[model samples]
Target: MSLFDIKRTKFNSSEVISDFSHFKRRLLDEVYETKDELQLVCSSTGIFEQFIEILEGLFLHIRQTQTSAPKIRLLFPKSKKVNSFLEKTNISDLPSVEIQYIHEDEFQYFIAGVDKSISLFSEPRRNFERGFNDSFFNVISLKDSVIWHNSAIFESLWKQSILENKVKDLSRELNRNNVSNHNFVRILAHELKNPIQPILGFSDMIQNNKRLDSDQKNELLKIISRNARKLDIMTNNILDYARMENNIFNLNLEIFDIVQVIEELLGDYTLQVNKKNIKLDLDTLSKKIMIKADKIRIIEVIDNLLSNSIKFTERGQIVISVRETDQYIVVKIADTGCGIDEKNHKKLFSKFYTTDKLGTGLGLYISRIIIEKHLGRIEGRTNTDGIGSSFTIKLPVK
Candidate 1:
């Protein structure tokens, strides 16, 4: 019988429909008739997939023909197969569709309801055709108690599904954070050990090798000093990062000649630069450009940039330039080194992000924080020549 005939004949009563084709046609008719809301519950994953395919076509048809669409809510058993289907299909992208998952054991029957008018119910079956053929349903024009009961059950289950989803999302976030913390500890330990090993080795050699020449002793002392400086820089970076996280970091603001600081810092790197056979150049229009800011933090930033340039450049030169614009004092450290990839430019200043194995990954992050704290800006990009990378820092002249 047609759905209109069935509704007229089966008013205020229920009937068992044993024909799969007839049941499918009636189900589609009910969905098409729905004006406000449509709810569905499917226990069998196989049957649910089939229903999704059928509903996708009906939904498209409704969109083309109808002026308004009903809000669709679907509850299905959570399973690997169903999850895979959802990932592969665009059914969820339908504008009116909202889906939630429940454990397989939580529900045993398939149910569908349309806006207080009709409800289809079926017992668990192995296949979609058999399930639909064995279904019993109710259709009424008035307020039916069966439809009301089904709506209540669906509302309760929907709340439970939302809670469970939130819990799962929180669990995944905690897992990711745990992994990140573990990696942070591992990298910090390795960085700490690297400079300490050399510092201890060189100090011991200087103390125990009494027969060594004066020049040999001086070289060993310089090696110890260099390693010690490295240890100091790494520890300071860690401490500063912690302070920044706690929002307790303070800068020692003062007026100082930035050119003098760069010159002195370059003097320290002369030996390392010569060892790598890389030329380092300084270009400045003024002998001393005085700025009111944190001198120590400014030195830290410039030192970090210069250190990276020297470490990466095996043969080419590094140029440190200081210039004055109308509103800002600009510093550019351009290097002909192994340049960073274009993809990684955005993440360069993110904490714990690094391309170097031995790095603590806090230098650029801390440098960015310090510069911004002083109302300045810093950016890194590939050089125009495409041979290396360049970092630019701009500080307000006023």
Candidate 2:
């Protein structure tokens, strides 16, 4: 009699097949006849290895031959071997295939079903070293009740798998954030101390050195002033961060000329630019482009961008440009400095992310929040010429 001929076995009942090859052949034939959906559950990587090739072939055949391929779901126990198999074969990348991992203790048998018409179940011997064929009990069921029962079990397991995976992901993220916050606290302490030490040193020299000339005393006062300003900026950032977290931050909006604001801001940086011997250039499409925004916050964003450009550019030029479209004003700050790595572009504005040892990593983050609050957007990227970096801000013109 034929190996799979139901007439030779039994009708509408379960048939036990002891031979592994015979069972595999029958399973493949059933899958080939599947027109709607396929569901599979493998208890271990050893069992999954025996049937992955057949599953891949079915995926290819359906993609090439059918207008709409059926959805296939495969559930496997979580194990290092299963992960390795998936990575090596790239089966997970195939279309219409969804894979999930269940806890090993929960998965005990191998099951495969085509639509709701037929299913194959086998409890392989736990001693995988002896091979699956040695103690396999294969059941092929054609009765509606039997197939329906198996399908119900698959649905329950699929939902459980999703919950388990999500919990694991959340746990990992929490651990990562804990580590990042620890590093941030250490860095913040160093950044805060940097400005304080300079201020204290310059003030003490001015107080104790009675023989110093007017020019020397004036220069020391200037040094103290600059360090005080740095402290002010850092303190503002910390307060603003707290306000944002508590949802109490507010904007004082007003109509003003954006070009004039930028010009005045650049004047404040004249001393720093000259000290570093870097050329600062400004280009504007018009003398005045009016916009409605929070003036202080807008200036804060521009200041942060200009400060970053100056900090990174050692010798080359820094350029600030402003132009207007029918609906918006565009501001760009470009510099010839050390360009940012492409991989880090997305993380530039993320909280607690920084590239410099002295940075609090809050400037760009706060800048993004302020711009967005004003219904504007900001972006940073490497300059087109690849010499440095550029930051662009776009705001609605009222």
Worst 10 residues of 1 by lDDT: 1-10
- Give the residue spans of candidate 1 off by over 4 A: 1-179
List candidate 2 stretches off by more than 4 Å.
1-180, 210-216
lDDT of 2 by residue, 1-398 (tens): 01122223343567778887788888888887877889998866666767776766766676676557677898987788778767865768767779988767433467888898887876664556676665666778885544654565565456446533443443354366564454655565566556656555665455445587879977766665675566566666776776776689999989999899999889778878999999999999789988889988898889889999999999989999999998779999999999899999999999867899767688999999998987889999999989999999998876
Shift in Å, residue 97, candidate 2 = 68
Residue clash pairs of candidate 2:
none
Measured with C-alpha atoms, the lDDT of residue 132 in candidate 1 is 50
Candidate 2's TM-score reads 0.53
- Candidate 1: tens digits of C-alpha lDDT, residues 1-398: 12332333433556666555566677787778888988988766755755665566665775675447778898888898777766665558767779999777533466788886777765433434565545434232343534544554565456446544543443354366563455655566566556656555665455444587879867766765676677667656766775786699998889989999999989889889999999998999899898989988899899999999999999889999999888999999999899989999999999778999767678999999999998999999998889999999999987
